[model samples]
Every structure is written in C-alpha cells, then in structure tokens.
Target: MELYRSHVLVCAGAGCISSDCQAVKKSLLDSINRLKLDKEVKVVETGCMGPCDQGPVMVVYPEGVFYRRLKPADAVEIAEEHLLKGRVVKHLIYQTPETGSAALTFEQIDFFNKQTRIALRNTGIINPESVEEYIARNGYQALGRVLSKMTPEEVIDLVKKSGLRGRGGAGFPTGLKWEFSARAQGKPKYVVCNADEGDPGAFMDRSILEGDPHSVLEAMAICGYATGAGQGYVYVRAEYPLAVQRLNLAIRKAREYGLLGENIFGTGFGFDVEIRVGAGAFVCGEETALLASIEGRRGEPRPKPPFPAQGGLWGKPTVINNVETWANIPPIILNGADWFAGIGTEKSKGTKVFALAGKVNNTGLVEVPMGTTLREIIFDIGGGIPNGKKFKAAQTGGPSGGCIPAKHLDVPVDYESLTELGAIMGSGGLIIMDEDTCMVDLARFFVEFVQDESCGKCSPCRIGTRRMLEILDRITKGRGRDGDIELLEELGRGIKAGALCGLGQTAPNPVLSTIRHFREEYEAHIYQHRCPAGVCKALTVYVIDEEKCTGCGRCAVVCPAGAVSGVKKQPHHIDPEKCLKCGTCMEKCKFQAIHTL
Candidate 1:
C-alpha cells in the first residue's frame, strides 16, 4: 500500500460524467504528474457526490476541501496550488446557494449537513470497484458475523425488530417479507435486488449501484443467508450503463474474494449473486414484472397473493428488495437493528433518499429522515424555490405520485402521510414546483408518462389511463368541458381500483392530487378558458401594449413565423392567425409590452 500526503476524490457518477468529470479527472492527473506530485497526491475517481447539479465535483481529503462545477481548466490550480503547495483553493470550494458562502469541508455544506445518509452511506466515499475499500468501511462484517454467529431466524427477527420497511415504495416490512419467504416451502429460493429504477428525475438506485455496489452485494448475500437462498439476482435497468459496469466489476471482485459463490466464509453456507439487466421498462419497477423481465419474458406484471415471498422468479419463494432497500441491509446487520430503527418515524424507519429536481435552488440528491417535513427539505436544505418564486407544489413518487401544494408544506414525509395525501412514497422522486408552474400541465405531463409506460396488461390501466390522459390533454389544449373534472375523477378512481398492478393503481395520483389541491386551475381551464400561470399556450393570447412597445423589431427578427410587424420607431403588431403561440416574440420583447390574455 502506498501512503499519500493528499487524496483527490473526483466524482465519476453518471451526472458528473455527462458534465465531463472524466475530462476533469484526466486534467487533474496530467497536472499532478506535470507538477511531480503523482507520488504524493493521488486522484481517486469515486461515485456520485450528493450535490449532482454542482458537478463535476471533488473533495480533497485530509483538508476535506470541497469543489463543485469544476472544468478541466480548474484542475491545474487544484493540482499545483492545493495538492503540491498546501494551499486551500478558496474559489474551488462548495458554497451554499442561498448565502453564496463557501464551505471548505463536507460537514459545512448545508445540503449534506441536513441529510442523514443511510442507504447512500458509502456512495461518493469509497471506490466502488475496489473490494478492499469496501472492506475498509466494515462492508461485509455484517454478513461475516451473520454466517459465523447467527442463524437465519435470528437475522430475520433482528431485521423485523428494526422496523426497516421497504424503501422502494408501499412500505412493506422488509423482515416480515423475508420471514414469509423463509417459511414458505420451496426447493430453490432466490434473493433479488430491484435495480430497475425508472422514475423520472430519480437516480437514487443508480447512484448507490455506481458508488457503493458492494454494499448492495453484501446486503443481498446477507438476505440469501436469512432467506435460505443460495442465489441472488439484481434486476437493474439496461439504460444505466455505468451502474451496470460497476455492478459487474463488483460482482467479479466479490466472487474472486470469496464473498460470493459457494461455501462462503468457510462456514459451509453457499450463496451467490448475478446481474440481470432489464430493457428499460418502467413497469418493471414492479417486482413481479421485474421477475418476468429477468426470466427473459415480456416485462408484464402478474396478480399477487403468492406475492414474491410465496412465489417469485419461476414459482419459487423469493425476497425482492430494491437497490436502496438492499443498500440498507448490511448496515442494519452490523450496527444492530435498534440503531437502524431509531433513525426515522415510528412507522417509517430510517432515511429516505430523494432526487430533488425541478425549480428548487439546490437541485440534487437528498437523503433525510423519513419524517422530515417538506418545508425543511424545500427551504432550509433545497435553498427554497429558485429565482424568488413562491413554492407552489411538489411532486413525490414520480409519475405515480401526487402533487403537494404549499398548504401541506409542513406535512411530515413518510409512507403513511404521503399515501394519505394521495401520493405513494415511491422510489423517492421529489420534484419541486414554483409559482409559475401550471399544475394542470404538470398533471398532464405525469399522466402522459404513465400512459406511455403502462404495460397494457389490464384494461383498466391500458385503456383507463389513456382516456384520462385524453381528457387532460384536451383540457391543456383549451378544449375542456365543464364535466371534464368529474370525468377525470371518475376515471382516476376506476383505474386506481381496477388496475392489475401498482403501475396502473397509482397512475392517476398526479391528476387526482392536482385537482384536490389546485381545483381552481382546472376550473379556470374549463370555465374561464384561461391558464392562470400562462403555461398553456393555446389558452394564451399574446398582445403588445402600443404605449410600452419600443418597435425595435427584435421580436419580428426572432419570430420563426414572422407574425410580428412594425415600423423602425413605432409600436409593433402581432398577426393572430400566423402566431404559433410559441412565445418567442414575448420572450424577445424588451419593452415589457407583451401581455397574455
């Protein structure tokens, strides 16, 4: 082992990679080598650091100097000045968005300070590809202890006592599910990690798999021990190429290290794990559908009763947990169940990781205790809404979730609370909306996504969602009727009650929640024929106020349809028929003369 004076941990997460963290890494290496600092300073490419928006990010250790939104050009200064000369690069440090004050350490950054990392404990902290790094962090200690000291029943009982529910939505008791599979009579049982995370703007599972794959692997092996299973399969989406690569590498390393494969830990206990890549089906997030995809069949859901615990993955009892859920396992085993149970609310224990996107100032991945209120997440942690906009609503659980208005800002976020508000605590996708966002349009967008992704297995989900989407589409297009709201409510309820699987069951949440919270907006679309937020272009008529118009012809030059006409110094006029309602003219108007009716 080489001892280094300084270690530069660069984020190689998918988001950071897309932002050219690879280039940033190369530049750092070149600069470090050029400065003759290669022996003294080491650059480690790690997984996603939580502040994904402000990436490519790096954290220099010993000093813990945090840097964000770095470019290749920035590496020279960091390598030469910070690494070699022992100088803190003040300009490269991470700063709070609201205060614009730089925080030199990870603990100082408010985004991280507010979060309690459970599932994402090792992500961004360790090199996921290296089993040694994983072991250094007490990675497989839980599995080793379980194999050496405890029986399958004890492990299940401890987990059950811990109150760790499934983080993949629906809040199923993790231990109880294991107990069911363990008790069920079967020849060959299986452990499954549902990595087919398809929620829009959600990358929690991908980050974990990319950053701390071994944690998941360790957890799965532990599950295999507890469930009397010798084999495990990770149902990950094919779209996540980086996650796939890292998982494959991790599995190979684990098997080579004897952490996986037969007769593990020299205890005569046999367990192994394999990766099953899904074809990017959103419905496959459903456990049954995921199993079907893994079995090389169409990714369609089957009726549950036999649930996965009773019969899963080829008529055998199975325990399926999502990537996030599995990541929590090793820690629960190592730290003891009580430690894990003490973190969150009574019903929903431990932290929940959310992909915080949309209009929030700090758009990144956040992990907070389950009962943390939305107000804290939105304002204190997320730096409130961006651009001085008021918080209008937030959408949790992606397309299958409902919208939460500002009125419920203080609501404690847990499985039960979210479900009570007409939203499921789905694979934690929290999208914040600002005052300017049109709720109706937002509902329509989610509905469109759900409709397109529906597997079309059952008529209710296949056809009902389409009809609801049509009604929503028509409303957004300025062709809504008075009874449209009632029609939507009827259809939404029907689909929720009749859909074959969870996909169709929760598909109407967005529409239902928007109506429940922002009925006025829906009413405006139908009765007043207007979109109050002016988001629906069809309902908006842009007209220039002659008094305020400067007639610079900026709008005319920019308009693709050539709808605007005016003299050099006179006010401009818009041809209604030719206007595409694209809002290009309004955006270019410098005089603030454009008004939408």
Candidate 2:
C-alpha cells in the first residue's frame, strides 16, 4: 500500500453535495496536484461528517483539521497554505457560536462527541465505494463468523438476547421477527431491507446505504443465513440516485467476493440480494406496501394480522428490517448480544440514528444511545438552538410523529418515553422548534403531509386526516369556532384508532401531540384569533414599532409589498393593509422595530 502524509476526507454525502462539495473537492485536488504534493497528499471523498449545516465539510486527517462551509477558493487555500506550508487554516476552522472556540478535531466537535456511531461507524471514516475499505474496517466479518460458527437457531437466539429491535420507526423485536419467518413453514424465505426512506427531513437510511452499503449487504446475508433465506431485496427510494449507485456497486463487489451469490464462506448457504427502487411514495414505508412495491404492485399498505413475517414478498415468509436495523446486526454478532443489549435502555436496545434538523444550531445526523435525554441531544450535542433562541418543542418521527414540548426536554428519548409523550420513534426525524415556531402551524403542516401521503386505501386516514386538516386550516385562517379544537381532537383520535396501516394509524400524531403539549397555542389561534408564534398570516399583522425604528429603508427595500414608508434616519411606519405578513421587513431591519400581533 502506498503511504501518504495526509488524507483529506471531503464530505460527498447528499447534504454536502447539495452545497457543492464536488467543486470544492476538484479545486483542492487541482491545487494539490499543481503544488507537486500529489504523492505526499491524497484526497478521499467520504459520506456525511455529522455537522450537515456546516457543509460543504472537509477534514484533513493526521492533523484532523476540520474545515466547514468551504468555497472552491477556500479549498485551494487549504491545499496551498495548510497542506504545503504546514500551517492550519485558522479562518476556515469550525467554531461553535456557543463556545466561541475552534475545534481542531472533528471527533472533538460537540456534534460528534455526544454521538455514538454504530450504523454510521464507517460512513465518514472510509471510502464507501470500495469494498476493500469496508473490509479493512471489519465489514463482512460477522457474516463470515455466523456462517462458519453459529447455527440458524443459535443466531436468532443471540439476536433475541441482544434485545435488538427494528430501527425503522416501529419498535418491533428483531429476533422475534426473524424467528417468525424462520419457522413460518414456507418453501422460500426472504429478507427484505427497507431503504425506502420517505420522511421529509430524514436522510439517515440514505447515508447508511451511501457510506457503508457493504455493511448492510453483509447484514442482509447474515439475516438470510439466520432466517434460512436464499434471496433478499433492498427496497430503496428512486430519489436516492447516489445511494442507489453506491448500493449497486457494493452488491456487485459482494457477489464477486462470493459473499452474496451462493454458498458464502463455502458453507453451502446460498444467498443473493437485488435492489428494488420504489417510486417515492410515503405509504410504501409500511412493510406490506414496500413488499407490494417490490413485487411490481401499487405502493399501498395492506392490512395486517398476516404481517409480513407470515406471508410476504410473493407469498413467502419474509423478514423485513430497515437499513439501520440491518446495519446493527453485524456489530451485535461480533460484539456479542450482551454488549449490544447493554448500550441502550432495557427495552429499546442499541443506538438510534436521527436526522437532527430544524432550528437547532448544529443541524446534522446524530446516533445516540436509546436513553439519551433530549437535553443532551439538543443542547449538549446540537449546541442548542441558534441565534439565542429558546427551544419550545421538537417533532420526532417525521410527519407520522408528534411534538415533544419543553416539559419533556428532560425526558429520555427511548421508544417508551417518547410514546408516553404521544410520539413514536418513527425513523428518527428529530425536528427542533424554537420559540418562534408556531405549534398550531406545525401541527397543520404535519397533518397536511400525512393527508397528502395517505394511500386512501382506508377511510379513517383518508377522510379523517382531511377533516382534521380542514379544521386546523380554519383555525389558522382566523375562522375557527369554539368547537373546532374538540372537533380536531375527535377526528385525530378517530384516525389513529381506525386507520388501516401504521401510516394512517400515526397520521394524527402531530395534531394530537401539538394539542396535548401546546393546547394554549391552539386556544390562542382558535378563541382569540392570534398565533402566539406569529406564523399564521390571517391571524398575524406586522407592525413597525415606531419607538425602535430608525427610519432605515432596509425594510422598505426588502419588502415585496410597499408596506414600510420612512425617510432616512427617521422613524418608519408600516401600512398594515399593504403588509403581506411575510416577515421579510423584520428579517431585514437591523433595529428591533417590527412586531407581529
């Protein structure tokens, strides 16, 4: 192997790619080559480095210097000054506004320090496209060990002892699910990996597939072995082209190495995995729906009682685990079940990967132990809410989840605790809400999402979500009546209880949780015709506080509507009739002059 003095890892995850990290990578490589340091230095493209908000993110290993929000020119500077001159780029160093200090190592950064990377262990650390790199990091080791040493029943028993549960939102015991398929008495058993991550702010599954596809492939092979399965399918979202490209590559490599095709490790246990890309339907996240989509049927949820384990994927006993859940299998097998079980809460074992987005200072991906408190995740890890804002609530589990209010900030983030607070651990989309977030609007937003995503196979989720959304719409639009709140509660409960699949069952979660937690906000919107967070346009009117206005034309210049009128260096006034309630004036005003009431 050729030894290099420096290995610069550039984030090639979708988030950083969106921020144009590709250009930054090219610029850095070009500059390095021009400086005749191509042999001395190497640039490697890796997946997400956690702190997504700071993208495009790059790190220089050996020194472990983290560079955030880099421009193409900045990469050139690092290649020249930092790489050649052997001096750190102090200006490009990552510094938290809360700490007011720069971090030398990405590991030492608060966003990563508080996280325990299990499923994401190899994500940012290695070149994901290479099977060799994955093998170097102990990938496929568990599959080999299981095939050579453990029996199918023994493997299932080990997983049961590990207390590992499905990480794809629903907290189903993984080993039990495996056993159900193993003993279902079918001709052909199948293992289906759910990579069709459709949550709005969620990219957890996609990152795993992109950065460490082999791990998932290895885990699926293990599942195939344990469950007595010969064939498997990975149901991935078609929107994730990068993940698809990487997964396809990984699958090819695994098959070439004889890990995927047949008789893996020469154990006569034949297994193969194929990628099945979904057409970006949210309801397909349900197991049966995902199976249906994989079988070339409509992406709609099927009623349970014959759950996927008994009759799934062409009427065969199938074990379906999400990307995160499958990724955890190898570690549990290698480390022993007890080791895996000890990391998390008694019931919900192992760590959870959350797409930590919205309103938080450090918006990125986080993997914390099951019992990690919201306080640790939000403040200690996330560096608290940005711009000195107070956290009002957090929405977990995407549109299918509910709100966690300030009172539950100290609560443990396990499945049971979040469920008690009226939230499910639905695929780990944790959206933070600051004081400025309108809870009523938040509820409406999620309700609307669920309403749109509903497959309409069931009446409760289809019509009930629509009714609840209409009520919320009326409340936000200042046409709310006295009985609107009660009607919402009734409709939300009805939907939850009567809906067909988990999609419909959890459709009303956001509305119910927001009402349970921030009922006062709802009451204000309904009874008093006011939005406490000043978000509802119909209930909100932007006014210029004459006492604080300095007659700066900044607001007037920024406002699309000619609402603000002021002379230079004098008090300004806003015409309420002309104000669009867009809050653009307030955002532009240097002085604290704009008030919403």
Candidate 3:
C-alpha cells in the first residue's frame, strides 16, 4: 500500500464544488508536484464537511488542520506553508463565530461537534469513490455477517427491535415494511431506494448518497436479503447528477468486490441493484408514483390498500425505503437493535439528518438524536441566527412541512412532538427564520412551491393549494379581505383531508402551522394591511431616520431606483414614491439611517 506522510483532503461536495473546490484541488496537486513533494504528500477529494458557510474547505490529515474559504490563489500558500514545511496557515484558519479565535480542528467547532453522523458515517473521512476506503471502515461487514450467520427472519426481527422508523417523513416501521414484503406471495419481489428527494431546501438524502453511496447500497442489499428480494432499484433524481454518478460508481465497485451481484461471503445468496433516474418531478417522491416511474410510466400516485408491500413495481411485492432509512440498516444490524433503540425518544428512534439552511450561521447538514430540542439545533449547533438577528421561526419538512414559531423553539424534535406541534418530520429540511422574515409571505412561498409541484391528479390539492396561494398572494399584496384568515384555515384543512397522496396531504402545513402559531401576523396582513416584518413589498416603505443618517451616499449609489436624495455628510431623505422597497438602502447604510416600515 502506498503511504504518504501528509494527506490533503479537499471537500468535493456540490456546494464546495460550486465554490471552486476543483480549482483548490488542482492548485494543491500542481504545487505538490512542483515542490517535489508528490511522493510524500497526497491530495484526495472527500465529501461534505458540514460547515458549508465556509466552503472551499480542506482538512490536513494527521495534524487535522482545517482551512476555510480558500480561493484558487490561496492553494499554493497552503501547500508550501502547511503541506511542505508543516507550518499552519494562520490566515486561512476557520474563525470561531463567537470569539473570533482561529480553530485548527473542524470537529472542535460547534457546527460539527453537535452532529452525530450515523447515515453520513464515512463522509468527509474517506475517499467516496474508493471501495478500499469503505472496506477499511467496516463497510460491507454487516452484509457478510447477515448472509453467513443470520436468517432472513432474524434480520427482520433485529430491525424491528431497533425501533427505526422510516426517515423519509412517513415514520413507518422499516422492519414491519420489510416483513410485509417478505410474507406477501409474489414472484420477483423488489426493493426500491427512494432517492427522488423533491423537497425544496432538503438535501439530506442527496448528501448521503453523494458522500457514502456504499452505505445505501449495502443497506439495500441487506433489505433484499431480509425480504427475499433479489433485485433492487435506486430511483434518484436526474437533477442530482453528482449523487447519481457516485451511486453508479459505488454499485460498480461493490460488484467488482463481490459484495453485490449474486452472492455473499461465499454464502450463495443472490442480490443486485440498479439505478433509475427520475425526471425531476416532486410527485415521484410518493412511493406508488416512484414505483410507476421506475416501471416506465407516468409518475402519478394511486390510492393505497393494495399498498406497495402487497402489490408494487410491475404488480409484484416491493419494499420501498428512502435513502437515509436504507443507510441506517447496516448499523442497526451490526450494533444490535436494543443499542439503536435506546438513543432516541420513545416513539421516534435513531437520529435524523436535517438540511439546516436559511438565515442560519452554519448552513449545512446536521444529524442529531430524535429528541434533541430545536433550541440546540437552531442556537447551539447553528451558532444562532446570523448577524445577531432575533429568531422568528423555523420551517421543517420542506414544502410538505410547516413553520414553527418562537413559542415552539423549546419543543423536542421527534416524530410525535413535531406532529403534535403541527409539523411533520418530512425529509428533515429545517429552514431558520429571523425577525425580518414575514410569516404570511413564508406560508405563501411554500404554498406556491406546492402549487407548482402538484401532479394535478386530485381536485383538493390541485385547486385548493392554488386558491391558498392566491389568497396569500393577495394578502401580501395589500388586497386582503377581513374573512381571508378563516378562509385559509378552512381551505388548508380541506386540502389536508381530501388530498390523494402525502404530498397534497401535507401541502397546506406551512400555512396551517404559521397561522396556528402566528395568527396575529396573518391578522395584521388581513385587517390592518400591514406586514410586521416589513417584508411584503406592497405594504412596506423605506424611510430615513433623521437622527442616524450621515449622508454617506452609499445608499444612493446602491439604490436601483433613485429614491434617496442626499448630499455628502448630511442627513438623507427617501422619496416614498420612487422607493422600490428592495431594502437596498437599509443594507447599504452604515449609519443605520434607513428603516423599513
């Protein structure tokens, strides 16, 4: 084996890649080769390191020095100073959000320390494209042990004992779902990994698939073994090309290593997996719709009861589990069910992976135990809201979920708890909000997303969500009626009850949850024709605070519209008629003169 004295691990996740992580990789390699240190130093591209706010991130192994926000030009200095001479790059070190102190180790930062990383176990720690790295980390051991020692029924029983419900938002018991498929009388029973994650701002599954594709592949093979299915399909979205590529590569490598494609540690058990690309439709996230898409049909959902377990995928019994749910199976089998069950709350077991985004200081992926409070995730792990902005609310579960207000910040984030508070754990998309965000506009945003994504198969979802969006649009535009609030509630409830699939059923959640928690905001929009957050443009106007203005002319330079008239070093005046309500003046003013009202 080739051993290097120093290893430079560069982040190659989508976010970092967009931030020119590839250029960082190239520069490090070129510098290493140029410096004659190629034999002693190696550079490898790893998956996400979670602190996406500081992207183009790289970690030096053995020493574990973390460098953040590197430009292409910064790479030579990093290689020459750190990799060549073993001296740290002081300028590139991560700045601690609170104290402004530089942090050397990424794990020591609160953003990484608070995360558990079960599904994302090997991500950022190993080369994802290398099967050898996966094997060294105890990758396919669970499959070998299950095939050689445990029976199919035993595997199912172990998973049942683990108390792991599906992480794809339904919270269905995974073992029970597998058992149902195992017992159902059908030929060609199939296993499907639902990677068509269409939820806006939800990338938990995508990160797992891109970072640790082997885990999902191994877990799916385990599911195939336990359920007596020989064939598997990973229905991933075409939009996630990186995830698809990694998954494809992992499958090929697993086949070469004899870990997949008919067999097992010489145990004669046969199983294999294939990848099916989705057409980027949100409705394909539904189980039946996903199955239909895999079968080369339109991605439309059918009413259940003759559920997927009984009749799925070409009219044969099929077991469908989401990517994250499948990723947890191997660990549950290896660690024993009781150990897994003991970590989370009474009802919801194991950890959840959330795409922590929007108005958060540390915007990235986070995996915490089920019962961890929202306050910990929002404040402690997320480094609180950015720029000292007061926390307003959090939106969980993507378009299919709801907004949780400040009153529920202390609520424990579990399946039942979030549901009791009027939010579902739908694919674990947590978008934080600050005092500047408008709750009514927030509801309208999600409603518009659902309205556009609705398959139009059912009347309640197709027409109801559209009407809801229309009402929210009117309210935000200062054309709301006195009865609009009650109308929204009535319509939201009807959509939830009358919809055909989970997508439609949960489409009204954001509106309902926001109204339930911040009804006063909705009332303000309807009755007073005002947006408390001053975010709704039709109801918002920018004015200069005479006491604070210094007439810097920065606001005048930035305003797309010529709304501000001021001389240098004097108080400014804002022409309300010319102001576009873009808040450009507020952002540009250093004196805190511009106020949105």
How badly does each model clash, as a count of residue pairs? Answer: 0, 0, 0
Over the full model, what C-alpha lDDT does candidate 2 score relative to the true structure?
A: 0.90
Give candidate 1's TM-score: 0.97
lDDT of each: 0.91, 0.90, 0.90
lDDT of 3 by residue, 171-236 (tens): 999999999999999889999999999888888888888888999999988988998899999999
- Candidate 3: 10-residue stretch with minimal lDDT: 98-107
| TM-scores for every predicted model | 0.97, 0.97, 0.97
Model 2 vs. true fold: TM? 0.97
Model 3: CA > 4 A from native? 550-562, 565-572
**In model 1, how large is the Cα lDDT of residue 579?**
88
Q: When superposed on Cα atoms, how far off is each prediction in RMSD?
A: 1.5, 1.6, 1.6
Local lDDT at 253 for model 2 = 89
